[model samples]
Target: MEFFNKTGKVAVGSRLRMLTEKITEDAAKIYEVYGIGLQPKWFPVFYVLSAGEEKTITAIAKEIGHSHPSVSKIIAEMGKKGLVAEQKDKTDGRRNMVSLTPKGKEITIKLQDQLLDVNAAIEAISAQTTHDLWKAIEEWEYLLEQQSLLSRVVEAHKKREAAKVTIVDYQPKYKAAFKALNEEWISTWFKMEATDYKSLDHPEEYILDRGGHIFVALYNDEPLGVCALVKMDDPDYDYELAKMAVSPKAQGKSIGWLLGQAIIEKAKQLGAKNIYLESNTILKPAISLYNKLGFKKVPGRPTPYERANIQMELDLRS
Candidate 1:
C-alpha cells in the first residue's frame, strides 16, 4: 500500500509509476468534473490532433515519446469513440494519417477551458516544493544520458562485493594456497630466495610449529590473499609480518588491507609488543598500506633476503 514511501530511490521505477498513476488519477477526476468524456491517457494524442496538424502514426509516436504500437492502439480507441479518423496517405498507400473528427474538435474546444485549471492545479502543487520537480527531472535525465543508472548500479555492486571480503585463519585445505599465493606475487616482483622457500615450502615447520599464525583472505570461500605472523627469536612476543600476497584478480579489491588487518589483530591477540616487516622502497603501494596500519620507518638493517632494503615497525604498546 505504501511501497513508494518504503522503497524510496531503491525502487525508482516503481516510485515513478506510482507518481504517474497519482497524476493520471487526478487528471481523470478533473475530466469528470469538467464533464469531458475522455481518459487522461488519451490527452497527449488528442492534443496533438487538436493542433490541426495531420500526423502519421510514426510521427505522432515520435512527437509524444511513445511507441508506434502504443500510439496506434490509442488512435484505434479514439476512432471507436468517433473522436479521431484515420485516412490513407494519397502519396504513400502504406502510410495512414490521423486527424481529429468534427466531434473531436468540439470536445477539444470544451476541454480547452478545463485544461487551464488542470495546469494551474499542477503548477500549484509544484510550487509547494523547495526545488522544482520538473527541473530536477530534467537534470536527472541529463545525468542518465551521461552515465546510465544501470552502470552506476553495477559499480556500486562491485564496491559492495569487494568490501565483503573476509580474513580467515589458515586451514588444512589452504596449506598449498598459502605458498601459491605468496609465490605468485614474489615471482612477479622478485625471484623467491632460499629464505622464502624455507618458510613457504614448510609453513608447518617454520611458522605454525614456532608459535606463529597465518591468515588468509577469502571471497566466497575462494582464497584471495595471505599474510603470516612469525614469532621472533629475540623477543618471544615480537612478530614479523611477512609473506603477504593477494591474487592478481583480487589485487585491487583491498584484499591486502583485509589480510594486513587480520594479521595485525592476530599479533595483538598473541600479545605482541611490536610487529616488524622488511620491504623494498620500489613497493610504494605496499609501503603506503603499512604506513596506514601505523607502521613507521626505522633504520635499515642486514636482512636474509637480498631484496629487503626498507625496514618498518609497528609498536603495539604505543
Candidate 2:
C-alpha cells in the first residue's frame, strides 16, 4: 500500500494484478483444504465441464468467455491431471469434444460442498469492506467492454500528440503543404479536376483573395493537414468547407478533427449562418467526422467537381 503514495495514479494494472495474485494464492490453499486436486487457473474449465455434457472445443471456449487456445491449454492441463477427458469427434476429425471424466465428476461433488462454504466466506469478507468489491469489479468490466483500455489509452495519446499541432493561418511557405496534402488524397480516391487545381495550386487567388480562410495544422514544425473555408455569396450559406486533407503518414493523430474544429470556430467568428460541404459517399471517415461536427446531409446543388456526390450543411444558428 505504501507504493500507492507515489504511483497510485497510474497503477491500476498493478493493483489488479496484486489482488488477483493474493486471491489465487488463497484459493489454492482453500482447494487443498477441501482435498480437491484442482488449480485455481483450472476452475473455470472445471466449472464448464461440471455440467456433465460433452462440448466441442469452440463451444467450451464460447461458454467460458475465453479464447480457444487459452481454453484448450487449460483443458489439456486438466486432461493430464485426470480431471477431464477429450477426444476427436467421430464425424469431424478437426473438432475436439471434452467432458468431465469419472475422476472429474467425483471432484465436482466435493467442489459443490466446498464452494458453499467459500461463497459464505466471501460474503463475510465483503461485509467488512467500504465498497462492494464484486459489484465494483462488474461495473469496471462493463465500462472496459464499452471502451477497452487499449482504445482509451490510444485515444488519449492521440489527443496528447494533437496538442502539439499548432493551427496557423495560410502563409507563402505553407502553400506547398496545402497543395500536396489535397492532391495526395484526391488522386488516391478520385481524379483531380480543374476545380481542385484552381484552389490547390492558387489558394491566394481562388480562396484567400476571395475573402475565404485556410488553416494548416503543424506538428513539430511540419504542416501535415489543411482545411479551407471558402467565402460564398449564396443566401443560404456563408462559407463552403472545402479542400480538407491530412497526409497519409499523419493520420490517426487527431489532426483532421483539430483542423475541422478550428475551421468551424473560424466560420462562427466570421458571423456565418450556415457552412456547406461536398463529398463522395466513399469517404466514410470524412463523412463521420463531419457528422460529429454537427453537419447533416442536405439537398444537392449543382457542383463542378465530378467527385462531389453528397452535399451536407451545418446550421450555425442551432
Candidate 3:
C-alpha cells in the first residue's frame, strides 16, 4: 500500500525533511520567548501574514507551495489557536478567505526582532563569518529556487542550469601551476604586482596550517583559479583570507567571488568566529563583489603582501 516503501528516493526525501525539521526546531526554540506558536509547520501561515494579503485557501495554498486541502487543515488549526481566522469569500461562497488575527500580527513583530538579534549575534561572533552566512544563505536560496524551477520544467520534458566559491583547500598537483596562475591573475585581473612565495607546500598542508582550506577552478583539465584561508593565531584577529586569484581566461566569470565564498565556508566549518581579508581599493571589481557578498569596510591592518595596497575584512558569523 505504501508506494514509496524502501525506495532510495523516499529515503532521501525523508532525510531532507528530517534535517529541515531539526533546523526548524532550533529556530522555534530561539523564538519561543516571543510567546507565539511559531513552529515549523506554521511558517507558511506566517509567510502569508507577512505578505499581508487576505487570500482564499486555494490561493494561499498555491502561494505557499502546499495543497489547498493541507493549507485548509492548517488554517483550521490556527483558528483553533486564535492565530488566524477564515471567512467565506464574498465573491465565492465555496471559498474561504484567510487572515491573521491581531495576536498573530503582534507576535510576528517579536519574531522579526528575534531574527535581527540572531543576525547581530552572528555578526558579533565574526565579521568574515557574517558575510559568509549571508552569501551561503543566498546561494542556498538560489539553488533551491533553481531546483524548483527545474522540477516544474521536468514535470512539464526537462530543463536545467550552477557558486562565488570560497577557496578552502589547494591541490598539491596544482600548487606550482596555481601559484603561477595566481600571480598572472593578480597582475591581469586586479592590475597589482605579485610578490612573495611563502614556500611550496601541498594545498592540504596550508589548509591544516591555517586551520582552514582552499579551492581551485578548473578548465579543460587545467587549474584556472585558486583561493585560500589563513586563521588568525590571535583571538582579537579572528581569521584572515589569502592567496585568491583567477586566470585571465577565467576573467569576467566572477570566479574570484566563488573562491571567496569557498574560503568563507572553509572558515565557518573550521569554527572560525570571524574572517578578514587583505586587499587593495584599486581592485574595484573584486571589492564590489565582496560588498555585494556582504563585506563591509572596516579599519584593519595593511596587507603585508607587497602588492596589496588596500585591506578589507568581513565578519563571518553574521
TM per candidate: 0.54, 0.79, 0.43
Q: Candidate 1 or 2, higher lDDT? A: 2
Residue pairs of candidate 1 with colliding backbone atoms: none
RMSD of model 3 against the true structure: 19.1
Q: Give lDDT: candidate 3, residue 232.
A: 66
Q: How many clashes (backbone N, Cα, C below 3 Å) per candidate? A: 0, 0, 37
The list of candidate 2 runs beyond 4 A from truth reads 1-11, 18-26, 51-63, 76-82, 85-99, 116-132, 233-236
Per-residue lDDT of model 2, residues 263-291, tens digit only: 99999999999899999999999999999
The candidate, 1 or 3, that scores higher on lDDT is 1
Q: Candidate 1 lDDT, tens digit per residue, 215-293?
A: 9888888998899998888643388999998888885577777778888888888778999999988888899999999
Report the number of the highest-lDDT candidate.
Answer: 2
lDDT of each: 0.88, 0.92, 0.67
Error of 3 at 40 (Å): 61
Instruction: Write the residue-wise lDDT of candidate 3 on 1-318 in tens digits.
Output: 254455655365576677678777777787676565766687776777665678887788778789978888888888888888778889989877788888877777777777688779767856755357557757967887878745654443311111332333555677786668766756564543423344224455545465756677665556677766766676656677777677766664556766777777767777777777767677777778778767777765645566566656677667
Q: What value of lDDT does candidate 2 attain over all alpha carbons?
A: 0.92
Worst 10 residues of 2 by lDDT: 4-13
